[model samples]
Target: MFKWKRKKKWYRDFVNPVHEFRYAMEFVEETLEEEKTKEDQILILDFILSVIREDLKYDTLTNIFYREKWFDEGLRISLPFPYHYYDEKGNMLSIYEDKAEVKKVDLAKECVLVFPWHRGRMRDNIKNIGRNEFQYDKFNHKAYYFSPVNICFVYNGMHSITAGIGFKKGYIEAAEYDVTKLFEHVYTDGLYWYNRHNNQKLEDDLLDFRIGVIYEISKIKHHIEKDAT
Candidate 1:
């Protein structure tokens, strides 16, 4: 059995498309104030605006990371996080991470179910593996990995990562955010989009924390008014 305790709906302030847009602007503004060169700042701001424009115009807010060249080749890297799988009966079946993969099945003991529906989803993802259907376009599906304090976390694409493991494809292509302290903590199943699917509601802890961190790290001195042009 799975346990899901509902929390107060405090995510309304941070998780909507509008708020996401604001955060992106604030993050870009603060990033501009940093010690980056003039050219780098311009490049970063341009990319940020492009992402925001896409989101506002097309309703396609894909999480993307910055790169020197947006059309460059995709990265090929191993699954960077530990992935745990449990049976329907809540028994730990396997764990995959890094170069060394571990597969274990223990039916005699049961573990607490954090996500009741995740196992079913993983099964579906496994079907998509090795089908040559995956594409990581640099412009569209560029970046999903987050590294805060040097620890890598996947802000998106868990199913694909799990499926890649099942297919034994090491060193998959990926793009990472090479920032430190962008987020202090990466909670379990805390992303707004992920929670939106399961709870039929939005929770903005992940986004909230990120925006807060951006302010803290950057110490932005002046307010950035919304661009009217």
Candidate 2:
């Protein structure tokens, strides 16, 4: 006679938020793999897009950032079509069914435009926050400096950074840290926040591309079926 043992939840909840996303994506991927025809793929994509649209109704900027849990690449599924994102230097970063690499982007080089989803409110705030007292000194702000990535993670004064960039103020004040002890966690968390914003934009673009793909595939599928008939 043996007693049943319950499985431990990693997040200490019924579902691990991180793996839940990975599992959902894995299911989508497996389903797509089993489809034998373009019509089948189109139908699957359309249904998935519909559900995603409904889910997005409640999704916000904060929620979107959490989607990049642990910065795992397995969370991304291939797009039906190629999608392009441009860097500050106008270099094209293309993503498609095969490419899933996340590039290390330079923030000062217009990476802000790469993810324009969070610009709505920040744009308005940028205007009202005057530049009269703006200073280039690092003593003015509370921000974490990631020496490995050479990027600053702002704990407060995000709008100040936005304003600095918006007006070309050149730089913001940040205290330099040894960060040797906490480098691993800081780097991972910083990268997670950085990639999540980019991934959110990528995710949105993929959904739109999926719709277009469904439309094109639907017509082609119809033509094929009609010709066979």
Candidate 3:
């Protein structure tokens, strides 16, 4: 009887996994269908805008990066740094130097200091951001910094870059706040036009740490202005 009961429980556990797998598959399929519809609408809008005669104006605000060509190469450009560096004595280092070094040494009963090697790259760990598709040209010295708040929109045939700001958390809030504002400024003065375009809603789209740092800087700037007043 014990063996029979054990077999029954094992069969029940095996079936449960299959059931869960089916449910997840169905959810993913539904999401894919929704995304396809949204993409279709955006393509349609692009076609319409291409032939339109009226001047197409979009909101320039809320874009974290400036829309400019940094080099002759086909690349979107933005300034990512307002960085700060300090030494062991808390002295700020100048950017003019080729290399900065820190040093320390130990003798029999005393301590000595010597310069340790240090080199800084213009772009460090830029892959942490969402720019996985673009290749960085280090020799050009154009891709200097990476900004969490700045996103560059580049078209296939376009040489100029359109700068925009986006949260790491997909497009839910961006659709509501940033995209909506852009559409209103461009398409019509009326509201809710961009909100209607959104179909798939992300469940857990939240601000990333890098974006949080940008917000903190804004807050600091606000306080400084307030204090000045």
Candidate 4:
């Protein structure tokens, strides 16, 4: 009798988009069990695992790296810091630098405080309230459309960050006491917009830490992917 044997993948361990996702998570788990890590490295590994372990739709929704108008194609994202979304465009136009060494002051010096969320990109902050509602303050750089959905963008220093019940496809602006019990940390659960404010409700350390890990992972995935490629 003849039997079929499976072929092995030639890519780096836990690097491919397919089965590697599970391995990626395992790698992180093993890393944790193997030895202790610094906060920065922990942030990176946690994020990577969170993203890789998501379902398909949610995973696609989370890839908000490259910075460019919908028209740009040949462009791809490659950076250490997701200092800016559509980062390649930002780099070409001298808007945002992509070095890990750049301080928050550098971003402030350029008058850019925070980057907007791309397709499935998210923001990480610790607050008392919840709901994906962006504050409409003077420092606000992104443009927001409050219609059927919260559509946002940047044109000449206009960008947006939202805090509300928004879906994965668009943005929303909610109140401090607006978050529903949702899984903001699960990779494939899709993004459930949430932000906190001065109005205290409750605190879930695990949730906060997970959301933060998601941001750090999303921000740094491109750089890791580039390195692997």
Q: Please write out the lDDT profile of model 1 over residues 1-229, one tens digit for every residue.
A: 1222223345554466445545665676577679356556656654543443333212211112122322223333323222333333434322232233212211111110011124444557567666755443334322223232222233345445444434544333333333222112211222232211223222223333232333232222211211211
Model 1 steric clash pairs: 75-173, 75-174, 76-171, 76-172, 76-173, 77-171, 77-172
Largest TM-score belongs to which candidate? Answer: 2
Candidate with maximal lDDT: 2
Residue 175 lDDT, candidate 1, scale 0-100:
39
Clashing pairs in 2: 138-173, 138-174
Task: Point out the higher-scoring one by TM-score: 1 or 4.
Answer: 4
* TM-score list, all predictions: 0.23, 0.27, 0.17, 0.24
Q: What TM-score does structure 2 among the candidates reach?
A: 0.27
In candidate 4 the C-alpha lDDT for residue 150 amounts to 13
Q: In candidate 2, residue 120 scores what lDDT?
A: 42
After superposing candidate 1 on the true structure, give the runs of residues whose Cα lies further than 4 Å from its correct spot.
1-120, 130-143, 146-150, 170-175, 181-229
Clashes of each: 7, 2, 0, 16
Give one digit per residue, the lDDT tens place, for model 3 in 1-229: 9999999999777764335334433443454356455444334433332322111112222121334323334333221221222333544432213232221111111111111111111122223223533322223211111112122222221111111112121110110011211211111111111111333222222112222223223333333345556
lDDT (CA) per prediction: 0.34, 0.37, 0.25, 0.29
Give the alpha carbon lDDT tens digit for every residue of 154-184 in model 2.
4444445555544544455443333222211
> What is the model-wide C-alpha lDDT for candidate 1?
0.34
lDDT of 4: 0.29
User: lDDT tens digits, residues 1-229, model 4?
Assistant: 1222222332344343334334444565565566554454556564554343243213222234454433322223222111212221222211132111211111101111123343322334212113344343434333221111111212212123322212212222221110111122212211122222222222222222233334334434434444456
**Worst 10 contiguous positions by lDDT, candidate 3:** 109-118
Residue 30 in model 4: lDDT? 67
